[model samples]
Target chain A: MTQNAAPPPKLILRFTIIGLVIAILATAFAYVGGWLDPGRLTPDRMINTLEDNAGVHEGYRRNHAKGYCVVGSFESNGNVDSLSRATVFETGRVSPLIGRLAIPGGDPHANDGMPPIRSFALQFQLPNDEQWRTAMNAMPVFPVSTPQAFWELLKASQPDSQSGKPDPAKMAAFFAGHPETKPFLAWAKTAQRSSSFVNVEYNSLDAFRFIDAGGTTHFVRWGLVPEAPFTPMTEAQKQDPDFLSRDLRERLDKGPQRWHLIVTVANPGDPTDDATLAWPADRRQIDAGIVTIDRAQDQADGPCRDINYDPLVLPDGIAGSDDPLLSARSAAYSESYNRRTREEAESATSSTQEPRS
Target chain B: MNPRTAGTFSLPARLLHWLMAIMILTMLFVGVGMVATVSERHVWLVQLHKPLGIAILALVIVRLLVRWRYGTPALPADLPPWQRAAAHLSHWALYALMLAMPLIGWTMLSAGGYPVTLFAGVTLPDLVSPSPTLYSALRFAHTWLALSLFALILLHLAAALYHALIRRDGVLASMTRSRKQP
Candidate 1:
């Protein structure tokens, strides 16, 4: 059966069949591949646009550009271990943590007392070799529900070159159209600026799922509730440019700052997908543990410098909820992290001098 | 046929072969998924991709040792020289692909200053310093190598099928079934 008897037409037919299949697969891949959605918002483009709007500060995080690192440990009281089988809750478990406290702005040297958003990002190393990383903001509620809306908010509030302020018309239209911003705006208008980062209650803003030993899934939002009393910053302190950083350093020098990790359990039909909505205050709150931050360090050489703090990095028994913004935020956080790290490396290479302490 | 050439593959050989087959297929899909989208799902996929690629790297080393020590069974005496040459070349190519893919992935991540965190506590030492230029180059290499590995797999499958079905040779059976011969 040497193919002298087999006609060339048969060979042609076989090639055509194979070619057809390849063409179809290539078309399918192109159609459903990464470029399928041509105008789809991409993480890189989102980050690039962010940098374009909020000018890049070399070696600094694009969003929370100004920050210092803190070292601490989270000691679980073992009460919530029954609710979730995570190792961090295994009775008296003291998991070491490194965290960053920051103001959410593009400028790293922005005034600390501008009534801007305060953020807390942390990484916990549990006994069982699993890690949990979370980033929380002091905002009572997120302004937008969807990631698209968040991007739109950034665009709408982009500062005018001449005035160095966002166009009032654009800002008004954005706020007027998005009713979800009402709660956040109302909170902002009357909210008291905290005396220090040690006293601010950092909220997760996104919901997450906690899986129990029994495999039951419970939706919850967790955050650090500072044990320090809610004292507003004095007018004189507000006038100081470095109040937040200075206050934290002075307070930590005396002793550790403490916060109770509170998990707010979601009730039946609670909104888990939208960060803009707040759950009822009466929802059962579980005091997961105590987070005592002892040492504050410059982010330049701190242990927390390298950590991405992506909110989706959860240990066993913990998982992300269906929040759309959570994914978008996590994606953007990585882009921010990558850019800053690369910039840091570049800066380190070009400079012959040791980095300033 | 030689009576004592070990017509069937040893249990260790068969187990590693099948295990690696499953792992490699999953690796391909995970690689695609991780790179395709910027959703939070990308995080999950990347986590899966890193450890799985390392596992393949570990097993491929063990597999090469096994190949050297035990060796593969001989092809049928009637098989063409071209098929025999192909069988020889494609095999080493597969092994080469397996070895290069993970090594490149690790190096690329290192170049990008990304940790190869297998678990919370387990991280592979970076093979290179954080260099964007190097990272971009290695990234392209890893992707093209993956596509080559994919094509090689399809070719390998076709050859195996031909031996199992068209030729009715025991080449495929030697790796699969425990029965040496009926």
Candidate 2:
């Protein structure tokens, strides 16, 4: 089998080329196959840990499992075209929106009042026929900066079975190790529980790079500031397991709920990569547009259920920043999406679409 | 009766070869774009991808039947034993991937519980049950196979060009439309 009628020219070159291809294949497999990766904390590992912490709810999002779908429209105010050439920012143009509002944690049946953080995920159908998706939270900043620290935080904060609360010593050690979590945790402790989802400001805590028509780059964090009166949840409303969903439906039934889309531009020195840090309050804030939600539906069968809502899913003018969490979230979210879509998810409550129960 | 010394490929064989070559290359680019992109732009690529894959699947099967009926031109006698063996193995790999890619993609999508929707809203039946772990494994396999397929194609192109240009042999032309005997 080794004999040949003639030997091909450049035998050394051919062997070298073969060796290089094999090397490239090995490296690629090492990356996707795990073990050879540096951090050992891969996206698959993160989701597995999450399932261990909070058992999986079939056919639902791994995080923020319980939520309702929203149908809305966003109107650009003509101010952002200079900063971002995205077609979504065409002056006076309105784009269709589908979104969701939910509390944090994997348990699909968690109480609305218990979780301090609320999440809003949006899918924007831009004027140019492209789509942009983002997952924002009500917190001004995140508790942990890196995915590794966040994973550790999840493990450390597991509640004691008997007491139904995390061990104080374990939390103390975690806080010391990750001092970055202190500020966000403090904010959570003092932040008032809003009675309605419309009253809260949903912040895209991770900054993104926006490229303008002139090829100028700006790092920006954005959020929706509600026009609705900032009201606290009433004691009676707190007793209802479905208060947030109930309140949202009731408000939308009467009229559209509105929020100003505020895009915050960062200064040259702003820490765009650190989720645990926030830029100064006086930084350039652009009143991008008004977001109006006209109606709501059950997430189970609604348009929003199938969407991944990946934060990194940006349009042409936007790109992900160097934040470690950006790639981390994208990977974990993809894994979560893959897992949930495969199951025949069942909504526990069907009578009232107010909440999936 | 030697295949290499025979006249060029038949009209139908030549047509199918070029047609499939365009399709398979487009499929590779589309597959790469589908995974790298995060925007809703990927939505269109994905929609284009499913139907393209189904088309290639159908064409490849027809291609095998055509080959069975008409037969291929044999390799040149003067070609080195190693080169001949390499050519044989790579061609086998190409056929294997052409069939396996669409099938694996269909199975992966099925395991992920996604509809194998094609043109005119025709959906293929699921080949397997929905299981997340199984879905992930299939996805991984599909990616590796595509990479391998892409690598093989590059090598195939290199070998064909070597015969056409450097070797000045008629091996490449045997597959082409030219009827002139070598």
- Predicted candidate 2 versus true structure: per-residue lDDT over A225-296, tens digit per residue: 999988888899889988999999999999999999999999999999899999999999999999999999
DockQ by candidate, in order:
0.17, 0.09
Candidate 2 lDDT over residue span B1-182, tens digit each: 12234466776788998999989877877776554433333445666888999899999999889888888777776677899999999998999999999999999877764546563225577889765556766777888899899789778877876665445457778787567543
> What digit string (tens of lDDT, one per residue) describes model 1 on residues A81-164?
887877887889999998999988777788888745789998988644367889999987999898777878888878788998
- The TM-score obtained by model 1 is 0.78
**Candidate 1 wrongly placed segments (more than 4 Å):** A1-13, A20-33, A353-357, B1-26, B43-94, B100-182
Error of 2 at A147 (Å): 1.7
lDDT of 2 at B171: 77
Residue B171 local lDDT, model 1: 80
Best by lDDT: 1
